[model samples]
Target: MQPMSRKTQYFTDSVIRRMTRISLDCGAINLAQGFPDFDPPQAMLDRLAEVSHLGPHQYPITMGAPNFRQALARKCGRFMGLELDPDTNIVVTIGSTEAMVDTIFALTNPGDKIVMFSPYFENYHAQALFADCQPIYVPLVPPKFNFDANVLEEAFKQHPKAILICNPSNPSGKVFTYEELKLIADLCIKYDVYAIMDEVYEHIVYAPHKHTYMATLPGMWERTVSCSSLSKTYSITGWRLGYAIAPKPIMDKIKQYHDFNTVGAPAPLMEAAVVGLEMPDSYYEEFGAHYAHMKQLFTDGLRRIGIPFTDPQGAYFVLANIGPYMKKGQTDVEFCEEMARKVGVACVPGTSFFMEDVRDIVRVHFAKKDETLLEALNRLEDIKAKMA
Candidate 1:
């Protein structure tokens, strides 16, 4: 038989998911995958229960269920400050994972170049490769996770087809500010490139650091394809309901790809998630407050344990430097497995998220309940002795 597609050789299975499995095997507290251990909003749960018994169990429209799309348009338009037409601007997808990949397929041809920052979500690299596109990586300097404008302009000089921006970035937890975003928008306009935004953590941003929708920037409304999901905001990751909003022209292509891809997001789940989309502004305020509490709880414990880590402005993940605990010549991957087994805590190795030669940093999330985080911190207190 012929060998499998060469694209499969470019990347390994998801290290984030691998660490989750290792955590399960060792009975460790899982800080590897970024999912909350608590229940979703009670209202959504109740609505889901009702939807299960009442209909729409089969398939909805290929674009999306009408009520879901309308709710999404109203909610997103209010926040994004844009008038979105449910019929023309939205394509519900099977999570932002599919939303992103479908947007890539719709926007670029094979061998096109895409710009992305280092220490990005692991899925972006794989998505680019799967689409037969090359990624031009621009590093976000550590401690602050800021990128140099000159460096970014240099990548844009390569005339890449699109640039993927993950606001409230994963693995590093840096939230891009408005001035920073304006710099990118200016460059995108100058270079005539598309901006594919992964804004899944839009509502989870910390205070003093706001999420600026890329499409909201002047001259960007036409060129930006915004992809997000109900997973993080609603704490319903298992629901797998996500959507992309773009101009009608771009969305027509994305809708075509989505139609042939998954046919549509789960019908009953879409019907149920409408409650989440229709939630009031106060709901998001409380949601952000809850995450702020979790962030404070986990980071304060790390400080008490004398572990140095990057204090995130947004997103729940933190990059902790465990260089002091690493054995001589030990890779982050090996250290992570050993830590999982011996210390009863799990985290993703930093190498999984970086393009540069980086080790000694492990990414862990604080999205769990307070008890779970406290337990993980308690186990981590003796990490130096146990790993040494």
Candidate 2:
């Protein structure tokens, strides 16, 4: 037999998906994958059926469906304050997954260095490898998940080809504030580097904190490549609809690569997303309220069980420190597996987020029903009893 490509051997299966599978096998409440079990907006559902009859089933434009791009331009303009030329600057993608991979391949030359925060979305490392680029990891330390300014500046001084920023970040659920994003923008401007932002959780933010668009900052529009999806925003992960908002030149390069990547995102799905992109401002407000309610419900559950955790300011994930309960020399994978198999509550181990020594924290998702969260909490009450 011939050998597999080196690229194919570099990565492992997604730890998050595997955890979700284990949860299913145990019939556990899955707080592992960050997907909501709820339905998308009623209007989007209606539009999907409407588009099904409209005959876009074959193939739309190679870049994107026209109506979808126009709606996206309008929506992004309203929120990010950028006048986007849909034809020149937006390239619809299968998901932010494809967007990230495409953008990295487009912008990074072989051996180019890309700065990515540790505990980032796991695919990023593989994307760097696929792009034939080097990744310089900067750690986002826990609890608040703050980064040191000096550390960021030092990485910028290396003149990296690009930096990947995930706002309302996954795993820890830390939303980057305007000030933090400003510092990043300044560094990018000074270093003449690209800023690739993953803002898929843009509308799922909680109270007091807002989702800041990296491209909206002064001088950042030209340097920023923004990737986002309808997956998290509308709870329609299976739709595989996402897009990149960047300068014409960057989008041009990205489109050439994406044209052959998936050829085009699903045609009918893009037609249906027009309705989602045009949803009212109140939809976002109510969306935030819904996420806030879930966050409170989950946090309250953790508190009742005497588990210490970081309260999420934006996204739907919670990272709880489980270090205090390790009496029989348990590893993170062991702990999480036992938690799922024995207690019927599944979560992702923090070790999957970083390459460092700390795996004492477990990442949980709050994007579930109240009854579901309550049931998970009830299961967690037995944690102390299981401790040695």
Candidate 3:
């Protein structure tokens, strides 16, 4: 029999999705995946219904439907602080996942170095491996998830071809500040490297902590490829609508990679989501307020139950310390499974998010509805007895 591709040997299945399977098998309430339990905005749903009957169920151009690109260009321009040429600057992909995948393969060559913060989203590591790229991990130390400037600068000295970062980061929930973004931007410029940013949580930021587009920084516009999605902002994860915004030359290569891969996002979903892209600033204000309320509600519950968690400044995830729950020599995976079967809730073991040895933590999320979060919290109240 012919052996399979060697690249498959570099990684395992996603622990995030793996935990959802454990939840189903154990009859546990799932908190592993990050989608919201609530439905998308009523207006968007109504728009979707209307658009479904209209035409163009087939692929809209390979780049994107004309209307979708224009809407996205306007939205991006608001933060980029410059008018973006939709025709030349944006390429819509299946989702931010594809956006990153396309950009990585488009810009990087085999054995080129890709620098990323440790404890990153699991998919980024796999993408680098699949591209035949070598990943250089810089630790974003826990409890605060802040990186030392010297340490980061030293990493840039390795001559990496690109640096991948997620603002309002997944798993960690650390939002990079303007100062930090500037540091990264300056380093990218100094090193002549590309900055591939994940800005999917752009609209869901918490108060006093804003999301600044790295591309807006001086000297960064041409070097930054911003990959974002409507999935988080518009609550349309299943819709698979996302885009990569960059300067003309980079986007041309990205377009080729994107077209060769998935071609483009679903036309109907793209049409429906333009309504969200065109939403007023007040809608985003309310959007942040809603996520703020959910974060408070979930973390407040964890506090009352006497569990320790790193409170997030942005994004919907919380990395809670589950170290105390594990018996001697037990793995994070074992503890997560026990937590699911006994306590009736499931989470991803922290080991999956790291490049180094990691345990004593697990990722939970508050992206669900208030009632759903409350129910999960209620089950979590007996953690001591159940986990024992």
Candidate 4:
């Protein structure tokens, strides 16, 4: 009989996915997880249908199939304005989840310190622990989620090995502005720290707000590891397609880690998704407009229901202030559970996304279809009556 590793003791199972299962059990409309209940581009589906019979099902090159990496490098260059050598730069992964862990493992040794923002995607916190490292948490002041540059500099002085930046961040959906990115980029360079970026929402940014690649920053390409996925962009969350783009030195190690951990992302799936990677600029433009429309529809619904929430600049989740509804002794978790079972809508308790005590908010995603949003809102309208 033996005990488990101490590293895992710092975290538990994903609260987001857990709530999703609970939502399923309660027969609630599951807005708890961020997967879209819509179809991906027809081009990808058609490609998949064709590729299925062609059969590359076994495995591809360790880092990625040649064509896939070429497509990715071309896409990255076209979008980010940087020509990347696919052979040395990209490590295709089983979703950004793997890309992140791979980067963490490849770059940091146990006991190293890594900088992370508060109210981050919950997985980052767990991954820190899993990587046997400590995170220096810098708070992104709420209501706007802006950070104090001075405060961030203090965190960097802690001599952390790297900073994990989730631009167009999750939960809060606060896209880091160019100035903020410059602040971070400056701090990283000054502190001689690496920047590990999660840019999965690169294409999901709302207009008037834009996503800037950290790797494209002056003198930062070599020090920044850009990790992202096709899940959110292409609506193929189930495909588990993700990757890390770094300079050769870093990517060499990431590739070694990824190769042993994963033979490679599913071969046939990569072949099909390359079609999405090569999509026209108009395709991405329409994508942003579609999400903008959904965001407007859902947020407008919340306002009509008289619920207070922070507006998202990018990504699809809204962090609603449900403080008024937290009855005498009920915690956000209890309120969320009751909302799912009785109110018939499911959401993740906001506490899950924070490093500090944050229990007045719950996260809901607007990546669903219009009909689904309408139904969720209609059910939410009876919140007071149902909870009372």
Candidate 5:
């Protein structure tokens, strides 16, 4: 066999994706993967159907499909309050997964340091490693899930080459406020470092909590690389379409890496996504409302059972604190495995999402049918009773 890459040995397969498979194997109600169970809007489906038969199914422009890029540019410009050049500033990739990977590869040299907030999307750490960049983790403290400004500033003072910021973050679902973004921007500017942002949940914020676009900050747009996916916005995770938006010069290099790496996202999917990218303001309003419904139903169930969970400001995850019910010897992972096998429900352990002490936490997904969530809640009640 060929020698394995040293990088591959450092990380395990994704715990969330692994739990999702176990959820399937055990025939459990799966709340492990963050994907939504609902179909995308009819407009996108209809457009896809129209394009499915139309020719032009060959390779798209390696950077992105022209129409798709134009639509994305217009949409982002309108929403983010920055003029984006369709041809030079955007490069569509397979997903935010690929976008981040390509960004790291294009920007970082071996031995360069990258600081990422912990409880980050698991892929970020792996990407940093694969690029031969050292990853420095700064933890987001619990309950409130807020970062101390001093700690974040200290991380920047290390003169790290880059920072990965996930606003409306994964796992914890803690959206960074405008002031928070400003603080981070100030540090990045002070250090003259790159800021790669994952804004996948940009549109899913609950009321009273807003999603701040990192690129909108003063003098930050030029140094910031913004990556997002149509998956969360359009509820089309399987479509595998995402993009990186940056200054034309940075995007020029990112596209070179992306071209050699994945070539481009699927042509047909890109065509279909134009509809989603062109959706009206009301589409977003309704999207927020839909997620709000799911969040309410899911959180309300947890509340009824006296289970404490971090109330998400955005994103689809709910990180429930199961500390009270954990038995004398059960680790969070073990408890989650038993929940799937015995209660017929599946959730990811919080420890999988973090690199620190989080034995009493397990993360669940609310992006399922009402009946599905109800069943998980019922099983959780049984868990509570048994532990009590």
Candidate 6:
């Protein structure tokens, strides 16, 4: 038999998803993957029930369902300070995963260089490789997760076709500040590079840390492909509703990519999620507050258990340092698996998210219920002894 494609031959299964399976096998509380154990908004649930019976069960428009895109345009425009045209500027995707990959395929060619921050979400590197692109990784130096402007400019100077930014970044939870984003915008403009933004945690920012839209910066709208999803914001990761917003010329290509890829997001789900997209400002306020509460609950529990973790400025994930808990010569992968089996908690090994050799950190999420987080923490209280 012929061998598999070289593009994927070297790829291992997703470490995050693998940890979730390990958690299941061990009957541990699963914080490995970032999905919520709680319900989505009751409004979206109610709408979904109605849509099941009312029936738009078949595929909607190739670009997206019209009402869904319109709601997204209004909601995103209100926050982004740009009047988005749903018809010409948006292409709904299966999820931000699809939105991101589709944008990459649409914007870049094989062998092109793509700049991305180190310790990125695992998917970005895979997506670049799938497009046959070279990734230029700029480290978001750990502890504070800040980048030096000089280092970034040097990456930009490589003249990459596009740069991917995940504000309120996963694994690190670093929210790029306005000044930092402005510097990035200036560099992109100077280098004539495109910016692909993954702002999935846009609404989950903690106080004193703001989420700035890359497209909102001056001279950036024309070159920015803003990708986000209803998954994180609406707590409907399974529904897989996401979209990309770009200029008409760029969006035309993205729509083609999305159309051929997923053929549009789920129709009934889109219909249901429009209710979420149209939710008022108060809904977002309450949403942020709920996540803030969860973050505090989980992080405070970690502290009391004598576990050291990075307090996130935005997003629901926390990277806990487990170096002290590991056995001699134990890899993070082994430690995480052992953690699930013996410690009754699960997390993704930090090795999955970095270009550099980082193995002492594990990424866990606080998207679960208060009771669930409490139980995980309770189980973790004796982790030192259990792992030993």
lDDT of each: 0.94, 0.88, 0.91, 0.92, 0.88, 0.92
Q: Can you tell me which runs of candidate 2 are displaced by over 4 Å?
A: 386-388
Error of 3 at 326 (Å): 0.6
lDDT of 1: 0.94
- The TM-score between candidate 6 and the true structure equals 0.99
* lDDT (10s digit) by residue, model 2, range 1-388: 9987788687788888998899889898899888888899999999888888986899789899998999999998899877999999899999999999999999989999999887888888888998889889888887788999999899988879999988989877889999999998999998999999999988878767888899989999888999998898888999999999999989999999999989999999988888888889999888888988988988988998899999887778888888886656789888888888878888888888885677688899998888888898988887867654
Where does candidate 4 stray beyond 4 Å? none
lDDT for position 21 in model 5: 88
- TM-scores vs. true structure, each candidate: 0.99, 0.96, 0.98, 0.99, 0.97, 0.99
- The lDDT, on a scale of 0 to 1, for candidate 4 is 0.92
Which pairs, if any, clash in model 4?
Answer: none
TM-score of 3: 0.98
lDDT of 3 by residue, 48-67 (tens): 99988995699689999999
Clashes by residue pair, model 5: none
Q: Give the backbone clash total of model 1.
A: 0
lDDT of 5: 0.88
Top-scoring candidate (lDDT): 1
- Candidate 3 or 5, higher lDDT? 3
Identify the superior model by TM-score, candidate 4 or candidate 5: 4
TM-score winner, 3 or 5: 3
Evaluation by lDDT, superior candidate among 1 and 5: 1
Worst 10 residues of 1 by lDDT: 2-11
